[model samples]
Target chain A: MSNMPTESQHARGQTEPSHGAVRTHVISFAIMIVLTVVAFVMVGAGMAPWIVVPVILALAVIQVGLQLYDFMHLNQRGHSFPAFFITSGALLGLIFIVVLVLWP
Target chain B: MEAQPRLVNAADRMELGLETSTLEGRNKVLGFWVFLGGECALFASLFATYLTLRGQTLNGPTAKELFHLPLVGVATLFLLTSSLTGVLGINAMHQGRRRSLLRWLGVTVLLGLAFLAVQVVEFITYVGEGFGFSTSAFSSAFYALVGFHGGHVAFGVIWISILMLQLKKSGITARKAPKVFIASLYWHFVDVVWVFIFTVVYLMGIMGI
Candidate 1:
């Protein structure tokens, strides 16, 4: 085990402070909050359904992407299997929704 | 050029995070991800059901009449903030800061509890307003989808609380790190689901579509 290269050596340069990570998370949080507020305001303002619906749905998708990639660490290295699993599941789920909703 | 030595010291092991330091730990993380995938599909089916039947109020209160934007907006803030705190706990775990991890996880549990409390109140209000689960197809679907998400949040709160106790006892080790990491992933997944719920159910419902 001692002779094998560690992931940290290859991926992370050194044992640095977690401030950078904290900053990244805080920034993500800010962006999510802004997206959420925008969605809420658009709806509360009684905008046309045609414009509000698709836009809020898009915002939701963006927020979920941020949660998955940033908060869940899917962007990190050595996560190919995890990524594949989630993406496939999401794709299947999307198909289910579309097919089921459009059936009638 | 000479090859660099590949000796993994304690610091390296710590930096790699005990969760992925060993084959077992790595497998545990992978398996949890698979489980999350299954959960995603499960929730999606519920979402589909809800979307299909959302307009069948059948004399009961419509979603626009039933849902209060301010309450739901507050609940979203709680869950969203909880998600951030949960990740911070994981970050602290990676840093080997046990106390920080505990503190952040504790805050997460509180936020989760707050979210649940808000949900309980919201449900009560709905029931009082004749929006019971059996009132109509729309109500049934709404409760099923939203209730399931609430159940996940409840489970996450309990799960993280128990993990906190274990961490306090055994400290953060390879065996426990994966457990903590997996729980956080589940929490984040729950939050992700809520994003859709708020958008599709609450926001759109308010729009009367």
Candidate 2:
């Protein structure tokens, strides 16, 4: 029983966020905005259609990462359950989409 | 003394607010994230339906034809900015700055309203352009996927508004902090979904598959 991890370890004051961490959020928001604009420009520029699709998709994925990590603080500890469930949901959603769309 | 149940020192309170300090707050906060995960799956199914049905305009204006770049761009900007403001609201919550939190949450809700307003205009415009709900399979799918998201935004706006009112009426004590914090999290999740929608639906639609 002594070897087991204690819940009190995660209790108050243990996981308090540092004061300087807000900068990462500001930087993340800037990057997301820039990426979104780049995407809009890439499409509106009338470049090769299907070719640009991947670029925009990649950009969208990056913005999602920023949202999850920077803004939502999924980067912090104690977020494993939230991360696990959300990722599982995303994976399941992907499978459902592939099946539904690819089905004849 | 009103005999506060848990008296976290003021300095420590900012860092470890209601959400992380109390057992109920921590549990509910984690539980809410899991609940949102289930919601994500629900939206995923809708997205799949939309993906399959898109571009099958069937004598209607196609996506490349109907999606106005400027309007969607505006909507996207509004949503992303709302996400930023939500982060600010959380920062204020962590600082125990009640007035700043209220201001930020108010801005967040206003941005949400703006996003919804733009969406309503977009839908109305699309309908006027002969892309009404029953126009085609693509129309139905677009409305369903995007409207579901819009429905969520509407609900979040109402949720945060009520939370804001509560905070204003009752100052930032222990109990109200967690509710406000959780509502901001909900708002952020909505913004994340908007990011995907902007990319997959509007931008990709403009690309015409």
Candidate 3:
């Protein structure tokens, strides 16, 4: 990236600091709210239990991703460590939960 | 060559937590991330334990009986909005808007306090409903996970309060900027935990999953 042409570098600089990028967050917030509503509807609509559960869970994953990537600025540069460590911890937790659930 | 402008007037804009990308600010932020990493592991274990014990109730009120969705839904709105307010505060910090920063942060703090108030009420309601901490395995796990999260939120409130005081007195000096940034991150992390709680514990339980 350092060796990039000045043209691209200038473009990158323009979009970088990104306080103006908050519009993305507003949009993300909208999507998250919609997703939350959908999740509630899915569960409360009295559909088949199996179908509703996975659908809610899937919407939740999207919301989590949106929160992490946009709201928390995990998608921003210079946050590699925070992103890595956070995901690692979550991964560890998932492994443990799976093991415990499957344990006889 | 990247012109390293060391100390771009620490008294001026403390955006990247410093004028220059000094190792001090970098290390501080890095160290805080490392701390959050450990925090994740800690919370993960709590979550896992909760999941395991969620069904172990010995004739006590099950999750379906105890969880009131509307009340939790309101609490969710508070915390979720606080998370957004926190993002605004952080944006203010980045833009070097001191007054706006304080205003946004103040709003964030207020929302967090409101969330805590609702949580305390919820706990009281649960206890009154006979879902006290020692009532059953499910009760204990529920308290352990959600209660510990509430404890983190409490600590975050105090932490941000002190940071706000420091910011007010010192302005956006490098000495305090990193601290403020980390505290903001901590607040967001707390909200993330709640997202899962709202899902796995509340929504799933509501679905009888």
Candidate 4:
């Protein structure tokens, strides 16, 4: 309820993004591309469909986590709600789909 | 004469409407996130449909039979790069660098277009091989999942363009901040969905379907 914008507000304007954050974004992108290529190779290799599904899904989930946490700053103060909602929704979605897939 | 000067200033202030709007900014970000959540559900339904009819390829080319890893790999690279560029767009905006922001956004949009182009070609390749959407449950699921994602990317490109225009007109005031913020969130969400799409639609398809 202050009349003036505070130091925190000023800091937001002055603070520079860290090298680590930038590095993380770059590395994550590289990893996603590499994993995508690997997935393609695995699919091309004629491996059992079961094996490929899990590996590709695992990588995809990893990539999604990186995008949310690293790039989108979903971990920041105001964004916690969206982050929680999105993660919970994804989990619920997976459960719903799995149950349907496995149900007789 | 002095009173007349004050009157003109008041008129100018009225015309400019110096009070910045906050509702559009806040709602746009929150609303877009909500929309993305619904999108997750939408894709979930499509995935379910795909799983249910996974094996019915109608004597057409199945995932293992028709999916080309190299082509999918190329498309994935393009999309992944686009996501990175989207982040750069945000970074530019944060620094109040409009030109840099637009440049990065332009790169992201182009990459998205390229991804869509590749997808169209891929679909054509599949159809050329007699793997039409109606041929079997497998093809149906495949097309449904991929098509849903492709539609999203198309929408996102249009959306970002509008945002760019808004930013140009208004600059990055607090009102515009949320729009850019939400669009970035939407862009990342699109990327997240692609992660799953890559796995379930492309990678898994090649394994056996």
Candidate with the greatest lDDT versus the true structure: 1
Residue A78's C-alpha lDDT in candidate 2? 64
- The full ranking of all candidates by lDDT, starting with the best, is 1, 2, 3, 4
The digit string of per-residue lDDT tens for model 1 on B55-80 reads 89999999989899999999999999
Considering the two chains of model 4, state its CAPRI-style docking category. acceptable
TM-score of each: 0.91, 0.89, 0.87, 0.83
Candidate 1 docking category? medium
The candidate maximizing TM-score is: 1
Looking at candidate 1 chain B, the ten consecutive residues that score lowest on lDDT are: B4-13
> How many backbone clashes can be found in candidate 4?
1
TM-score of chain A of each: 0.84, 0.82, 0.78, 0.74
CA displacement after TM-score superposition, residue B19 of candidate 3 (Å): 8.4
Off by over 4 Å in 2: A1-19, B1-16
Model 2 interface DockQ = 0.39
Better of 2 and 3 by lDDT: 2
**Local distance difference test, each candidate:** 0.90, 0.83, 0.76, 0.73
Q: By the DockQ metric, which is better: model 1 or model 3?
A: 1
Candidate 2 chain A lDDT trough over 10 residues, lowest sum: A1-10
lDDT for each residue of candidate 4 in A17-65, tens digit (9 for 90 to 100): 4446557778878887777777777767778877777787787777788
